[model samples]
Target: MPAMTVNDAPVMFDMDPETPLLWALRDAANLTGTKYGCGVGDCGACMVLIDGEALRSCLVTIAEAEGRTITTIEGLSRDRSHPVQQALVAEQAIQCGFCTPGIVMAAASLLRRNPDPSEADIREAIPNLCRCGVYPRLIAAVQRAGRVTRRRETISAAPAPGIDPADAARAVPAMGPASGGEADGGTTEPED
Candidate 1:
């Protein structure tokens, strides 16, 4: 077993020491926000803050994480109020959201080191790929997050945790009721 501080809580992984940190977090610890993307570390979907740096969880083993601090997306903010998160929403940088967590982690780490990162700095820091093609907006979001962190701006876009149904529906248009006979528990046969 290897011990480490995850999300400010001390945890001892019961799995093999050689297991990748991503699996240990997702499978053993049941922290599913750390996604599994490109197991070879080319994709940053499994990015997490290891000892205050954004690193690919798929490349680091549990043994390598021993005696270190790991911060997953869940640990970043329980209510999605982290500046990076807020900025992401405010800038509309998230679409499909699969890579958002990793991008958020990388952005958070970068802002910690450089509170006033330029566009180029953001580009270099956040190599996480967004298949939704949000690169332009992502850069702006990072910059906005830095500003929020520095007290130069404020964002109210990130919804609080457990948003009510009305607010949620307003944020995203509600889908119309299920059509066809399914609404009444009846099945529609396939067309011949």
Candidate 2:
């Protein structure tokens, strides 16, 4: 069994030591945010923060992760409030969303090390591939996130999670008797 602290929780994997951390997370731990792109590590889709460093979970085995701290996208923020996630949404840098998780993890790791990362630094640090070709916006988004992290700016583009029931009802039009619609068990249309 390999013991590791994941998302600030101590976890032990009851599987083969040689199993890749990606499988351990997705299959055993049910952390599916870490994706599986290129299993050989060329793709950054399996990226995760291992001890505050962006590492490919597919390339790192459970044995290598022993006693290490791991951070997945889910651990980054429960409400998508992380600067990286917010900036990504604000800049609309995500498409298809298959690669977004890995990109978020990579960007989060980069920002942690360099809160004021330059475009070049972001490029160098985040090798995650976005087939959506959001590279240009991604760079800008990272810069925006850096500013937010450094407290130089703020963004309210990312929606807050867990909407209140009342607010949700207000946003959505009433579909029942409240909207003047009949709530009776009888059919609305005339009988044939």
Candidate 3:
């Protein structure tokens, strides 16, 4: 109907208002993090935050989300190192990473609502399907992520917001001119 604001950017929905929010976000707004799962909202892969509430974007129509502040998984953090991601990585909860975004998004919603969620609460929050068989780890990760401890000492003062492959290579400590090894890109056999 009118212009909408998503992730602090204004956009106009020229198509019919009945268009699903997922397509509207992915196609029009270019927010692809909110993925397309089951169109009937059975799979929570399309879950997004609408005014702080988790909703299936595939089910929510543009008319429903008109002028609402919708936050996709991409909008969760500047980097993927958010607590959920860190815990998920720490717990080794991801496989194929298809269902994870939805589960993590749902768990993130749960954590925001209830900082200390129980096992049932965590499980109830994320009903999304995970064919990869990491559900236990997923649940545990959600728990661990909620009560994160930031290590000030280990954290460098100049933390990069996001890692760049090129920058990461530059940051590697220089190796002394020692004997060649696998890491030095040479065989360890003695010279002829």
Candidate 4:
């Protein structure tokens, strides 16, 4: 079977070509954020961006994804401060948090493709199962996060200086809106 690349991390799959990307990521690559929910692909738990489009990892075979660039929740950001992540935090949308990673990854990709996505677009992009029922807050956070990041990108590509301790102390996300509606966290997205 052909090999698959995940999050810029390369690995070989010594199984059949039909092996699902989800299994390859979890079993072979050992990256588990791509959860297995209704392996038929209706759930967004195992969603991963393949070559830019959000595709269910359960349905994509290693052979089909050979040499294609893939980004998982882990690859969404180097640290926990990623925009989408910060948005969730600011909105306090996490409950069980099991679905947070998947949701963030999906939303991050959506924002990347379309910096100014509509509320409906955000909803349509993240179809992941969230038993916590944080949809209302989640929607608000995602939209806010997208605006924040897009503003930064368009405003200035240069890196900003670190926040002073005094300012950090006052860095309460609620004091003011984040890049959009998310808070400013020290860390970015989660590690894959």
Candidate 5:
């Protein structure tokens, strides 16, 4: 059995040591946020934050992760208020949703290291591919997240009247079945 901390929670796995962390997280731990793109780790779709650094889970085995901390997209925040998450949401940086989690995680890790990274720096940091071709928006979101993070760090009490309270509040909606599409991406029709 391998012992590790995931999303600040302790866990032990009874699977083989060679099992990829992605499989361990999804199958054993029931954390589906860490996606599986290319099993060979060529794609960044399986990215996760290991000790505050972005890493491809598919290439990392359970035994290799022993005694280390892993953070999937789910663990980023209970209400999804992490600045990166908020910025992604604000910028509507998701489409198809297949690659969003990994991109978000990569951006998060970059922000953790460089809070005020340059545009070029963000471009270099987030090498994750999005089939949706939303890189421009993704960059904008990263910039927005940086601003939001800085505001939080510097602001003391109340934001100026001109500031959008929503940005400052970083409000997250309650988790449940939203009125859009089904869990399987099936379209939902409005009730008559």
Candidate 6:
């Protein structure tokens, strides 16, 4: 039996030593989020996080994954609240849902490496083939996730409040629809 940590929990597998991690996860561990697409490393469908890096489970033998951290899409979040998952949902990036788990894992890995990935960066990082041709929406989702991650980082990195409460309340540029009128050289009448 091989002992390993799966989804932050310890798991022991009693399968063939040469069995791929994909079967060990789905069959023995009951973690089906890691799909088997081409049974080879060509497709990203079997992608999973191994020690925080995206790896194709099909190509990795049980011995290779022993004593290492393995995180499946199911372990990404309990409520499916991972940024990648949330962005995919918001963008309606799902088609048949068969490819979503792998895509989600791949996206997570990409975001971890580049929090503010550009469209090209996302395209380059994520090579997971989607049969439905949802590349545009997937790109949009990656962009949105990047924005959210940046916003959170900004908020968390803000300095402590100044001595004067008034100083912390400094005014910011108007961001409402009225601001657009100003940019377009249009005057708005004062409300009565």
lDDT of each: 0.92, 0.90, 0.76, 0.77, 0.84, 0.81
RMSD of each: 5.7, 6.0, 9.2, 12.8, 8.8, 16.9
* Candidate 4 per-residue C-alpha lDDT over 52-148 given as tens digits, one digit per residue, 9 for 90 to 100: 7888889888989988888887777655667787778778888987777678778888988888888899888888889889999998888788778
Ranking by lDDT: 1, 2, 5, 6, 4, 3
| 1-192 per-residue lDDT for model 2 (tens digits) | 999999999999999999999999999999999999889998899999999999999999999999999999989898898999999999999899999999999999899889998889999998988888999999999999999999999989577765777776666545224432355554455337
Cα lDDT for residue 93, model 4? 88
The top-ranked prediction according to TM-score is 1
Q: Each model's TM-score, in the order given?
A: 0.84, 0.83, 0.75, 0.74, 0.78, 0.77
Candidate with more favorable, higher lDDT: 1 or 6 = 1
Please list the residue runs of candidate 2 whose C-alpha ends up more than 4 Å from where it truly belongs after superposition. Answer: 161-192
Candidate 6's residue-wise lDDT over 147-185, tens digit each? Answer: 776766211222222344343334322433344346678
Compared with the true structure, the alpha-carbon lDDT of candidate 2 equals: 0.90
Better of 1 and 6 by TM-score: 1
Give the residue spans of candidate 3 off by over 4 A.
149-192
So what's the TM-score on candidate 6?
A: 0.77
Candidate 5 off by > 4 Å: 152-192
Q: Deviation in angstroms for 60 in model 1?
A: 0.2
> Lowest-scoring 10 consecutive residues by lDDT in candidate 5?
154-163
**TM-score-better candidate, 3 vs 6:** 6
Put down candidate 1 lDDT per residue, 1-192, tens digits, no spaces: 899999999999999999999999999889999999899998899999999999999999999999999999999998898999999999999999999999999999999999999999999999998899999999899999999999999987566767666666665443444434477686666548
Best-performing candidate as measured by lDDT: 1
